[model samples]
Target: MPEAGIEPDVVTYNTLIDGCVLTDDSAGAVALFNEMRGRGIAPSAVSYTTLMKAFASSGQPKLAHKVFDEMEKDPRVAVDRAAWNMLVEAYCRLGLLEAAKKVVDEGEGRAAGRGDGKYKRMYVELHSRMFTSRHASQARQDRRRERKRAAEAFKFWLGLPNSYYATDWRLQHDGNLT
Candidate 1:
């Protein structure tokens, strides 16, 4: 039998927070976190990471970043690789590549010794995705430029009658399609 009237500790609360993440419940996670603190249960790194995951899964990077900032500010906690990874995941979920890159660089500096195989893999994957996205954006711009150039050429050609426009075509100023 369990001890009667035993209050939930950080570990128990963390499990609840993780459950919130699995169910895509950001608000519930936040509420549980607040309640845990209200009851003087010091949040561990896992607690923070799980709550951040809840927001990240819900596509709320701003909220996830807020949770990360709270975790970073907690003096009792030593920010870990998982926490850093979750922060990156939050930004990446929203396609915020620049923010994720900044976080990765910060991680490289702050958690350098803590970087494991997982962090290395994520770093490589993020860079590859960024490279692909950049190239894709560039290709789109190139196609758009080509299309604009073609349109301008057609407009120029339309303005000419055998390489020259009628003088009167340029003179029509009121309700003119020329």
Candidate 2:
């Protein structure tokens, strides 16, 4: 669109990002998102959530969570239920029940339960599909490991790159690990 002298806005980026998801092109979605930001077109909640959807659909919960965290930190847009739900869905896609549950619990608890039972149905469905303690144990370990890594990321002397902490920290510290 820019080739035609048409300035792409947030909506344009969101639509293209969502298209990338439909095509299972998550890297393309990320590229478009970064390009959007690089061009100074501030991302809306829809832009963030759409990019998160691309990551979630591509089974990249880590990237989805990163987009979600950026959305929350963005002064231009408010983090709404759709953004929260996309994050929950990302964990669900990975069969990470504990992570999804944590996000679901937080979402449901927000605003004194305004969106009360929405996640209950989805969680029940996803849990029924698992029907084993195996996934539970694995998810528990993953959650713990994620938290420990996030906490330890504060050690600047370790010299981990910025990309490491920026993306990984969002999935930790849900009132359980400070």
Candidate 3:
């Protein structure tokens, strides 16, 4: 990275870290993280999330806790459900039922009650649903319009001269033919 003239930013670091984790290369992830810190690049929520996932998947809960602790110290760090879900699954896989339960409870608490948090979730959900519905309605209207246009085109085609069938007769039973 230092060799390249391109300076490493948070986005670049995050991508490198994600690739390391996907390949189960925890050591590489750690090295890149240290390099990031040395370069004075503050990790964002996405950075922490990727590190947390790497640590958890690599069976290195100790390192995961280190990242989590750092996250807690950084007041601006926003831990999303994906982060919590990673811990929850990790704990469950390790048969740490209590820890898994605690993580789950904490996530639920963050999204709990009929207060502002709940209202915010509700607003997000409602807004997304309404937006989806509007898109679907527009699609339906478009289909209807297309069908109408096709019907109109067929009518015009039928109305053209010499467009009729020469014989419009039904078959008769037995020897009788129409």
Candidate 4:
């Protein structure tokens, strides 16, 4: 594009970063991000959110957190509900429930003043995930208890006197031996 005298803008760079992230090339995305900044192109919320999502999908939630932190510190970037949602999702994907809950709480607090609905949705989703996890754990415990009960019943049947092994069935059927 540069060779054709077409200058890359923020949107162009963001698109390229999105492609890189989709291809699992976080390094490429970061390089493109830095290049955009070097070229005096300010990153938008979409840029940071894309980067955070890439890092999260790559199993690097800490890097995602760094991206979120950078977004927060940048005055030009508006950390919207979408950005917060990405950060919370990253934390949740890593099974950092406490961290995700913190994000949800912060989002709710901000939403209360701004009247935004996205933050409320984030809170609901996080709570749902927590509930699902707890329910799965309870199901596993119930299965274990069921297996224990079955084992105990089998043991009791084996210990019953005069049930099968304690009586000689052949002798009882025929009084005289052949």
Top candidate, metric TM-score: 4
For model 1, how does the per-residue alpha-carbon lDDT over 1-178 read when each residue is reduced to its tens digit?
1278777999999999998889888899999999999989999999999998998999998888898998889999978878888999898888887788788777766645655555456545543433223446777767655554444444443232232232234435686433
Q: Which runs in model 1 stand beyond 4 Å of their true positions?
A: 1-3, 111-178
10 residues in a row with least lDDT, candidate 2 = 154-163
Q: What TM-scores do the predictions have?
A: 0.60, 0.61, 0.58, 0.62
Residue 175 of model 1, lDDT score: 67
Report clash pairs, candidate 3: none
lDDT for 10 in candidate 4 is 86
lDDT of 4 at 85: 76
List runs of model 3 lying over 4 Å from the truth. Answer: 1-4, 110-178
Clashes, model 4: 0
Q: Candidate 2 lDDT (Cα, whole model)?
A: 0.76
Clashes of each: 0, 0, 0, 0
Q: So what's the TM-score on candidate 2?
A: 0.61
RMSD of 3: 19.5
Deviation (Å) of 164 in candidate 1: 54
Q: Is candidate 1 or candidate 3 better by TM-score?
A: 1
lDDT of 2 by residue, 7-109 (tens): 8888888889989989999999989999999999888889889999999998989989998888878888999978987998899888997788788667667
